[model samples]
Target: MPVHFSLDEYRTRVARTVKAMAAADLDGLLIFAPESQYWLCGYDTFGFAMFQCLVLSGDGDLHLLTRAPDLRQAQQTSTLSDAQIQIWRDLEGVRPADQLQDLLAELGLTGKRLGIETKTPGLTAYNGDMVRDALKTERLVEASDLIAGLRRVKSPAELDCIRRAAALSDDALDAALAATRAGVSEGDILADMQGAVFRGGGDYAGNEFIIGSGEAALLCRYQSGRRVLDPQDQLTLEWSGAWRRYHAAMMRTLVIGKANDIQRRMHDAAVEALEACEAAIKPGAPMGDVFDAHARVFDAHGLTHARLNACGYGMGIAYNPIWVEFPMFYEGNPMIMEPGNAFFLHMILMDSENGLAMCWGHSTILSPTGVERLSKHTLDLVEL
Candidate 1:
């Protein structure tokens, strides 16, 4: 039987996280957000409206407080056998927060310093205040930084999942690029790409694949429209294949007609920048250094100002879990490239007088010496 993360593994990871929280002087951590809940409990439920909360004590005790109907599903999926499950039915005028307060009191956490996940946007104002009022003796602290720090580095298991996702994404990009032609509509090309992902035993693309032609290609993240490709235009296709809910993205620019001198120049520049970025990826390499490499390539071609962000972030474990983005140009962020970290390297160059050209690739599992390009597509300009 194939197991993703065993119960023992989850318990060990949670123990480590809780020990870190205790070292930071937190008595107990309350994670009400979905990602945090899944991280700690290995229980994933759809919809943000579902009221599910995970509470972990400094002693490594775990508890799940949720609505009554969800209790069975939570128990079935969670790795924590000892997880105390609490169910509540809202009575006249009683909010879900009130139920959480009762659960906290039951756990005898009245006076302990409690840490709350502040990232969940759907937390109600009344619930926030109720938690504070209920735990009258303890101070409420935000644990976003503490949790994010732990989640940024990928584990070996996480890297493996992302590697599979990247492979699937690469296959999808190949199919999409192959299906693209002078007369094909953007919609048809997108359908072909998505179909490839499904046929390859992966789920749908995690995001909308942007299949833009001609002027629309300049829009960077443009969605596929009714526009049909012309022999003289360029088609830029951006998409990813999702496997086990993890996503890996790839983008490429294809010229429909014989490339003009200007188009060829811009494509070469973009490819050079992408290659430079790929070469710069290594453990302990500053993310800024990688960004500067791409920037320098564009500057040498006099298209520095015409570029969007040099590259984009780590992909794996689905940003659905924690939303950790590693932008190349993020100022003062001292995150060095580390082994097991996956990133998307996108090189975008748009010359107003000509057209837009882009090269997107995936790099998963950066090693001590270098990084791995998970994308298997040819980086050279593809002419349809």
Candidate 2:
């Protein structure tokens, strides 16, 4: 099999997952999250946008139900035997969902307590309703976070992928800095960044590179508007570098010209917040402590109203819409920082009074000794 990790690694992951399954009282788990599948069984595929499910039983049994296009995909990239792979038929009477229910029945899992990832994109509303109605099982429970929590603690191999992606993130940022200038369109800069990402040996990011210039910089969402850069406006960029589906993110704001006093102050506070966050990333620190660090800086600067509620989140093994994993940095979150955990801590501050924004942050990995910054790029408020 062309699995990303060795078969031994895959077995280890399955063992850990089975332990979690036992703890949750899940006799069977119907995994719809693509990342969870890859982590558990090395089932790599972008085909999750369609329909597929990796069934993991507490007894260490594994099975996959997918369509024709992903049948070979699962065969080549996963460690499933031919007998364990079930191809769902989308026939008139036997829909794929019906086939899924049949497969569960064949395995005698229909009557057992089962866990499913209800929030993943791979689990659509139609398929969800279909599966529920087909099985008529009240034992189905929502268990998205159960596996996500396990995946948050990166393995050595996983960290290597993220480290490479982090280097690519620096390259993309450098390309963005090189391509950004007065009169250049945001789309043009974004295109340059994408090219840099691919040319630097990075895969497609989980989400579109968020870019905006002028007052639109306050909006962190991605848009296709062809807004041209101005001499005095600032450009905000929020993006990640993904390698083998693992991600490392960076957020920065670049001014096309000289920065004003308000802009500089905001930038300084954001930078301070980022540094404080890094210092607070040791093992045993609560996730909220990092956000507390971020809040301290903004509140001290009297910009509490201008700051975001969430500073950042874990980033690894993700797909479209976002690269963020669970255990985000927010107020009162008791999720503790542990070794092998990787997260991005961004300080996004928007000064509505001045119609300017200053976003500066980077991702880091918690080590046995201390926290290591994943991105090598300098965290400076660049004036292009």
Candidate 3:
């Protein structure tokens, strides 16, 4: 069953967002992308090419302007019961600029600081120039970072959904490992993994399942192919499960037969790096410290050259949500690890000579004392 968040909870979240917007001195925000719309109103809609916008005023009023076909669907999914929904008739004739002008007039904001999601609208056919000319307002500013800062912290209900997603992913991966064997094709293993996720009541995988065998595993993100597995081949499987749009990812490597000394050494290094990264994920700890810990592990194993691919990202309602990868691996990101911040710490190692080795794990909640590992699956290398 799909978990439903309370209307009051959503309303409170929107209120907090609105307060933040007001503090940023923005009179209104225009959200056109799927992720922003879902974040603001808990509503997901199709037909993004149709030029839709959800206008959120500083005074806490919500108005959705979209094409005719999406009104019912938006209303059904939206948590704001009293939000007004409007529609435009034709793409060129209805003029998003003119409609936005009228919306601004209705909200009585003729000369106010208007904020726009520059990243989202920039990808679409809607011209900001047309809207600026129509409204005669020059207060449009980029609000991507501001919105992202607001969404970095997750609520308790959101964390629960993520935990469930992680559990399902762990279960599916265990089943996939059991089904893998010496004679199984890479494609067959991927198909079985997907089936396991579905049987566990998951809606979808966060990304495509990767089943790379032998030389194919040399690629960090090798996709599944028709090649049959051999007794001496090494296999790597990367996949995740989704529940109510939240994602939980897991990756594992296995040897069909006994692993060579080089493979075992690489695998051990990856496991140690993964453990070090996981240990550094407590509240108030610098995120850079976690990355540095992994880097040291790779260095200790004389695998510093392979450290470029050693990192992970944030996970959540990924398909239609913004600000998923918070505290990313960039220089000078001083965001501290908070209790509700979910992150994945992946230690991926690949060499042209030895093949691929990876250790992936995640934590949905970072407590004051320690962190909670969302997926409970063992990290040991499986022998088929």
Scored by lDDT, the top model is 2
Give the winner by TM-score: 1 or 3.
3
- C-alpha positional error of residue 267 in candidate 1 after TM-score superposition, expressed in Å: 1.9
Give candidate 2's error at residue 235 in angstroms.
0.5
Candidate 2 deviant stretches above 4 angstroms: none
Least accurate 10 contiguous residues by lDDT in model 2: 89-98
- Candidate 3 runs further than 4 Å off: 1-3, 81-83, 90-97, 120-138, 222-226, 320-324, 330-332
Best-performing candidate as measured by TM-score: 2
After superposition, candidate 1 runs with Cα above 4 Å error: 1-3, 68-73, 80-83, 88-94, 120-138, 204-206, 222-225, 319-331
Which prediction has more favorable TM-score, 2 or 3?
2
Q: What is the lDDT of residue 335 in candidate 1?
A: 75
lDDT of each: 0.70, 0.87, 0.71
lDDT of 2 by residue, 1-384 (tens): 477788888899899999999999999999999889888878888888877888888788999998888888888888888888888766666667677887888888878999989888888898888878877863899999988989989899999998988988888898999999999988888888888889887889888889988988997888877798987889999988888888999999999999999889999999898999999888988998989999999999999989999999998898876788986899999998899999998899988888999999888999999989987777676998
Candidate 1: residue 367 lDDT (0-100): 67
Question: Which should have the higher lDDT, number 1 or number 3?
Answer: 3
Q: Write the per-residue lDDT of candidate 1 for residues 278-345, one digit (tens) a residue.
A: 88777787778778888888889988767765466766544232322434434244677777667777
- Positional deviation of residue 326's Cα in model 3 after best superposition, in angstroms: 3.3
